[model samples]
Target: MINPLGIVITVLYYKIAEKIKKISIFSKIPPIVIAGVMLIATLEIFDIDYDIYNESAKYLTIILIPATIALGYPIYKNIELLKKNKRIIYTGFIIAAVIAILTTYVVAKMCNTEFIVIESMLPKSVTAPMAVEISKGIGAIPELTACIVALTGIFGGVFGHKILKLIKVKSDVAIGLSIGAASHVIGTARCIEEKRESQVVMASVALVIVGIITAIIIPLFIYLIK
Candidate 1:
């Protein structure tokens, strides 16, 4: 029998790509729509008759790294601006990252969730792939971490622009910080769409800063909870 996930992903990936190419709205890249289609395709098409499919997915996931790396060129183009606004970019990212981990930890503890679960939730503010790696390093559930990451991304992508506008966050630097701090890669996409080159650079800085902060803090929080 043909692998179902392969068939489904093969079909829908192209469809989604086509839709994205043709559309020009926020709905074009809704994470829910993308992820929902992916999940549904996985279940319906992938036979799951054995554990091999799970193993194959690992190799597939590795391909995403190159895409992440491609983001670096854009950052390189704006490196001069980054050098100038170093303080603002670093300061905002550190504050946002710390708050994200601390808030998740405190809330998880208050709700009596296990330490590992909290550790998993700690990286929810980052991109999903990065969140999964961070979760694994800290002994958290990667799958659960992925779900949280997706939810965070969707929420950020869907409402972040409106929220910034409502709050009168007019500065491109500030807007970029908010998107990177809150939504990770999805937010970066939003920043670039506004034609703000500096904001895009700041968004990259925000993700890096937040990723580093989460890496150091999440593990310590897990230890403390243990």
Candidate 2:
């Protein structure tokens, strides 16, 4: 027979994590669920700090990359749709790139946020790992950038359709580009679910283009302003 204490601990921890993950409040927000589990576990356990877990978490995250790569299979399978609308898709990507960078820079500046904060915020629409690296390259806080990126993705995924509808966006290509431009990876996931071929392409383009743009623009702005 197994030890009851071990089983009880395992069940309790899993139950807590599952409850948080399944709840409507947390279901749509992956970053929050991930963070919540770590927070709760740390608080309930002995002598475990975020720093300690963070050092170890890098190893855990390596396994997650392959899972993310699996998401690309659907996009590859839908290449016919992507090819048919190449013109509209490319135009949408270009426009989306311009809007994402400019709006983020303008809003952060208008809010009187710090230059580094603004720099970090500019890449908040990119995938978290990429955003963190971009923030570091531009002399911003990686942790802050990661948090903002996660929040931006969650907001974009949850409300992208509403915003698109409100703005009367009619083209599927345009809609796809908008989601990719504003939401990054999470938005890409939503696009995949909708079978939006244009979006998948634009999202891939947006991730690369916007990342490159932010890496250039934010640093240049800091130098010019100072």
Candidate 3:
């Protein structure tokens, strides 16, 4: 049977983490990251089995499905913007997918990292699920891919807007696509926090489309290089 105790503990930890995020130094850090770190420490300190804790905590991932669908509201509200910029937006998605994959590959190769590690890192820009499947096909470690994806999301969510501002990027859609393409749902969630409807809409769209584009491109990229 599922353990409500795990759910209760996880939720409790998450709420506290959210409050902690209000601190100046921590304001840029994600609540999930804070909560996750604390939870891991608690588990280690107590010698608790992670699988037991995950019994109820796994259900929370189920909530993500509906949460993702709800993001469509912003997209619907901003339909005209998408319609007007369909051509540019479509082209941007392809570019976003290609650049993310290529940069990771090129940099990893340049650093002379192990090929398996590089493969695992390749799908880091996409969301977790897509990254896992892509990892399987490409000889990447799913566990490492998941970690990379999370870290990628955190980096983009924390630094993306600031970098955009520094570069004088003023367009909401451009910022949204850039974040979403690089960080997936986590970056999109950041847009929602800022309450920018245009960014939210474009980011919501960008994460999904960019994942699709990345999935399609990876195979072809592997084949061409081989």
In model 1, the Cα lDDT at residue 112 comes to 100
Pick out the ten consecutive residues of candidate 3 with the lowest summed lDDT: 64-73
lDDT tens digits, residue span 1-226, model 1: 4345644554566577557645666343654457556655666686554255545445556765675566467657767776886887777877888888888878888999976677778898887666777877877788788878877877787788899999888998888887888888778877777898878877777775677677787778667757
**What value does the lDDT take at residue 189 in candidate 3?**
87
Off by over 4 Å in 1: 1-28, 31-36, 44-50, 64-76
**Colliding pairs, model 1:** 4-45, 4-46, 5-45, 5-46
lDDT of each: 0.73, 0.67, 0.85
lDDT of 3 by residue, 1-226 (tens): 6779788888999999999989989876777778878988999999999888888887975675576456566557667877887999989999999999999989999999987898789888998777777787777687688788989999999888999999999889999999999999789888998899888888978887788788788878877866
Between which residue pairs do clashes occur in model 3?
none
> Which candidate order results from sorting by TM-score in descending order?
1, 3, 2
Give each prediction's root-mean-square deviation over alpha carbons: 3.5, 5.8, 3.2
Q: Give the winner by lDDT: 1 or 3.
A: 3
The top-ranked prediction according to TM-score is: 1
- Which 10 residues in a row give candidate 1 its minimum summed lDDT? 48-57
Local error of candidate 2 at residue 100 (angstroms): 2.6
Q: Which is the leading candidate under lDDT?
A: 3
